[model samples]
Target chain A: MQPNGQLSRFGAMKVALHRLAFVVLVAAAFGLMLLGKADTVLVTRLSHAVTDALAPVLEVMSKPAASVGAVMNNIRELAAIREENARLREENQRLLRWQTLARQLQVENQRLRDLANLVPDPRPRSITGRVVADTGGVFARSLLVTVGARDGARKGQVVVAAEGLVGRLTEVGARSSRVLLLTDINSKIPVVMEESRARAILVGDNSNRPELAFLKAKAGVSPGDRIVTSGVTGAFPPGLPVGVVASVDEGHIRVELFIEEGRLELVRILDYGPDGIIADPGPGAAARAGTD
Target chain B: MRPTLWQTLDQTARRLIPFGLSLLLLLLAIVPMTTPGFLRAGPMITLLCVYYWAVHRPDMMGYLGGFSLGLLEDILMNTPLGVSSLILMLTQMVVLTQYRFFVGRPFLITWWALALVALGAILLKALAIALLSGYVVAPGPLIASYVLTLLLYPILAWVFARTQILLTKEP
Candidate 1:
């Protein structure tokens, strides 16, 4: 073969190889997505590993953002203080009345339980974690909390804030945990209306308000109705306040979450039971040893 | 002959600038913006950087770099692995192929091309996510993201251009 022909052939080969590399890279990405869906454990572990390594750096980066947020919030609050004050005053009066009634009912219930000789269920323990990073994107809604597996955070644990239910711990790492917000498209919660006791599923669409689905026909759910976790599936504890029904028009009910995403700085992670409950490792080991 | 210490350091710094900037953009993407609508309409800065570097320094940025960056985004944002990777790699490949066309074009032409690429990238992301999750991922957020990404392209490109100038300066 001629030298120029050899060179041209080599160039063609290089072009083919380049195209092949591009195809291979795309195929590899597609394969990863499919693999992640098929085998969630591998994805979970990988997610945890990556988050754990980057948690410190994310935490540092988030501090400046948090400060900026605080300043903005303060400015907004100051502007709205007058109207907010009046609204809070009215709310405070209404809540005071409810508090009195609730205290009386609680006392009567305890007395009734005592008379019946019933054993009370154990109260769940909770750990507070600071928000270190938030991946608020068009595709997903998740936040990384400073606490993790080492801090007693575990998958399926309930993460809440002062306002209401925030989300669940989806991936817990050694030093960080990812909170899958209730607003994530993939998040679905079994909830019930406080007033009507009608059960439904809260489905997130990456919006501030999630929609209610699987509601019984003519369940009589209406706007302003309170929603709480049903706890029927055991994924979350019962009676955790989730949100209030914002609108119920044409069979579509939107829930206005009590917790705002911007205000999510600190959250509480609740440990309910022995199934992956985050207890001190020492005590947990001792308990297992005792059982054995 | 082996590279001297100064030469090795110079090479390392050159590689780190673009790679490090890519990562910094990722962190910026997730940074908690308190302003309403900011969170929902967060710009795809990493995507922008990927496109820019792929155009400017195709030799340094490739499939592996794009894939790794995308994987980082997926893990950070909790999306299915490879969702961002697939889109990012394709974006890099497309830009690299059209490098000559973009190289000498007016800023407006490059920006226009970037807008189209951004649209495709976002659509690809939404489609991949919907297929993987088996849910009809809404197109609203994706469109918002696309527009925001395109709008921010000029500012980001200016910054990137300055960085390029600094990087190319002789010691």
Candidate 2:
């Protein structure tokens, strides 16, 4: 081959390589997007792995920053003490009423607990974790908590806050796990409308309010209706408060989550598995079983 | 006169500046992911950085480089995969076409133009996501983010320029 022809051929090869690289990168980006939508498992794993690897460095860096932020917040609060005082006064009255209701509910809850214990499987092991980071970027909604497989934080474990359902643990590492926020576009929870018991799919759209999909038009759902996990998918337990209906538009309803994303500082990871509920004994089964 | 070895080294370093800056910008773009409500505003910081580099260093920050950085941002930020890449490539094209006008402009004017570009990039990204996903697109959050990015532009631009100057100084 002539020298010029060989040089030109090499140039063509270089261009081909560049084009191939571009194709691969674009394909990778598309795969990631699809992955982001299809399931939370991969994201959860990536998040836990990344954060676990980076946590020590982040801890060292964020400590001083957090302390500085706290100091600034304190200063701001001091400046607005009068306004805060008034708000607190109003809140205290509300708390008093809640306290009264809480006591009554606690007693009733104890009675129900006793009844449930008599049935079986009264105790379920649970672990508590603090939300160390809510670092899932705009397209991905996830929270990194300080509990992982080492702490019995298994995949698909339901995470709840003091208020209500937070999300399910999608991935777990040795000492950390990723909680796919209910608002992630990839998140879909089988939920039932509290008032009409209408079954619908709660789909996240990377927004504060998740859209209710596949809801029956005649479901008679209205604004302010509560939503809870139906446990139909055998992932989350039934009857956990998920969110409340914020707005109902044509063919889509939005939920105002009970657990605020910004304020999720701590959560309890339930140890319950797919077989959450134990079957109750049939009528006369107790006596028959005793004889056996 | 023929370029000296020192001149060649300086030129190489000058070209390398944008690449390093883009990485840092990509990291900053992902910072909002750590905080709630940060990502909804669009990839503002990223748009700004890409615009700046495309204007200042088009030779280095070409189509493929811009696209790759956008893709990396998407992976790190966990957004729709091609969303940032599409926006970035478009922004790079726009900035590259108008590179000459921005090269010698005053810092404030440069910042203002960047703010405008950031706003446009974000709006386009939001519209694309909405159309693709068939999701209920709220204009409110996008608007809020645009305003915030505009307000943040001068500070970020200043920091970026300072870093470039500090790093590329002739020893």
Candidate 3:
């Protein structure tokens, strides 16, 4: 009789535990629902930590698949190599003519540079890294690159591709870093209209075409106008190519980004820190020492 | 005299089988979560898992387990909170209620029932997302995803039943 009573008690305890777990799970779901849009610093750190832990496992799994994809791509490329060669030959001739023009422009640029003393001789070091992982999920517009703080990657450093600007490194781990893409909803870049010199906010809407919000009506912006960084925020350098104005619909403007977000292969993380350029020290060595 | 080793094995399997099945379903959820183009308007793998387990082993894969899987998917896929959880809980409840009909059905009939369940789950998910975001949800992707899921269900059901049989040794 005592053993039967004990068995029933144990069963009751087990049922209670199961009910407790259920309550916890439901509470977690409701908690996540309530905490929407509150970007706390702790959450950012947690996201980076989770990405850092998962990136290596993902990288290992993706390599074999990528190798198979590469082999398939090579086979396809071989089949089209003859036609591609003919196209490249014609493109090479056109490029040679452009190269001669580029040489003449370089000579004229040198002359202009000597006259204006405008060359600042930028820091000539950069770490090249491959884009190993894409943005983690549907809503996140960030990427995890292979380079991290161990590879001289620091937070707030601008990351760019061969085409144009990519984004800035927001969080850095020892082995991997998170880059907030320019097309993320939270990203807001101050940009200047290349043609009109008017300033506007390049706002990302988590879509392919980010909108240009907060542009003045008299800014005189039009479609096909070029957009470049205004460097007002100081995170990005001045005069970096951003995108082109694709459409202007009433008050909302959309830009066709220069660097394709989906097809990013390799990127160069600039060593240019936020304080890359200091104000002129006014010709005094002691003043420069204090600023440094 | 001591109980036979076969009896011990049976007892162990009876007690631990549900945990193993739930873990397998959780691992399956990771595949769809990681694959791109699948995250937004792709076949719902977790829903399939919930339906399969809810029908076959409701005692092991309960309402709470389904809800947790949905929550985990929501976090991993970055969907709006409670979206997947709500869908999964409803899917599990529906499957549980209708499980008696599926107990002795042939494999083809089981596949058809799963297709109906998947279609209902996808429609619910699309409708919820559309209402929440206030964007016109495209029905084309939803229908395509549902069809793909339905086509894949037969193969998965076969594998699931084979595993269950092998593990339980009840054939």
DockQ for each numbered candidate: 0.61, 0.22, 0.21
Which of the predicted structures, 2 or 3, would earn the higher TM-score when compared with the native?
3
Error of 2 at B17 (Å): 6.5
Ranking by lDDT: 1, 2, 3
Q: What is the interface RMSD of candidate 1, in Å?
A: 1.9
- For DockQ, the strongest prediction is 1
What lDDT tens digits, residue by residue, belong to model 1 across residues A155-245?
8899999988999988888999989999998899999888887888999988778999999954577778899998767687778899999
Q: Write the per-residue lDDT of candidate 3 for residues A106-204, one digit (tens) a residue.
A: 999899867755544346357887665554223346666778788988888888888888888877877778678887766788888877778888887
Clashes of each: 0, 0, 0
For candidate 1, the per-residue lDDT at A272 reads 74
After superposing the true interface residues, what Cα RMSD does each candidate give? 1.9, 4.7, 5.2
- Each model's lDDT: 0.82, 0.70, 0.68
Tell me the tens digit of each residue's lDDT in model 1 across B1-171.
799999889977887788788888787666565435564565777789889888777756667778888999888988889999988988988887777888877889888989888888888788888888876666677777788898888988898888888888887
The candidate with the higher DockQ, 2 or 3, is 2
Candidate 2: the clashing residue pairs are: none
The C-alpha stretches of model 3 lying farther than 4 A from their native spots are: A1-17, A32-45, A119-125, A136-138, A193-198, A215-226, A244-253, A274-292, B1-51, B58-171
